[model samples]
Target: MSRLVLLGLWLVCVLASAVAAIWMLIAVLSGSKRAWRLAVAHDPLANAAFGGNEDETISIRAGKAARAGER
Candidate 1:
């Protein structure tokens, strides 16, 4: 039916766009640029996730305890 054909076309378009977006993300991450560097280095969250600064400590305590409140 015409409706089935239209649905297939729409699905194809959505998949193509998703692939393009993923490629763009991969390209941006692989390149060595100032913006990406700053995004990874200067951003505290990113630094914390990737362990950027050697001097900085990230300690996590689980369960209910007084010492767990320090971090």
Candidate 2:
């Protein structure tokens, strides 16, 4: 019974997400240039969470922390 309920919840979530994605895609394709640009703009929080760069700084910091732990 519990498993069935969980499965139903998961299906509902998946369907909702699919609907939202399709809606966004339709909006993007049918909207104006400015509207499309607005939708494509990046979220500041997302950029921050991703560290905003695909560089070696993160690796450098990890290595430094590891070295400190060794001492």
Candidate 3:
């Protein structure tokens, strides 16, 4: 009876280890895919072509003042 209990415990440990390994692999794959997408989506030339210049300034305070004057 003691030997059977030991065997059952060992089997449970192995199954738990396998589940943990699979979960880690899935997490790593998802994070890598997200990093790849972010790297590909941020091109300065593409942003400029779409009139999204980083150097242009549209201040929040100025916008709020204009809106207040309009009202």
Ranking by lDDT: 2, 3, 1
Task: Write down the worst ten-residue block by lDDT for model 2.
Answer: 38-47
Residue-level lDDT of model 3, residues 1-71, one tens digit each, is: 69999999989968975775565567567775554444333344345445656443234334655889941
Top TM-score model: 2
In order of TM-score, best first, we have 2, 3, 1
Q: What's the true lDDT of residue 53 in model 1? A: 49
Model 1: residues with Cα > 4 Å off, grouped in runs: 32-71
Reference-based TM-score of each model: 0.40, 0.42, 0.41
2 versus 3: better lDDT goes to: 2
Location of the lowest summed lDDT over 10 successive residues in candidate 1? 57-66
> Of the candidates shown, which would achieve the greatest lDDT relative to the real structure?
2
| Backbone clashes, each candidate | 0, 0, 0
User: Which regions of candidate 2 are displaced past 4 Å?
Assistant: 32-71
Query: Which residue runs of candidate 3 sit more than 4 Å off their true CA positions?
Result: 32-71
Which pairs of residues collide in candidate 2? none
Question: Distance (Å) between predicted and true CA of 18, model 2?
Answer: 0.8
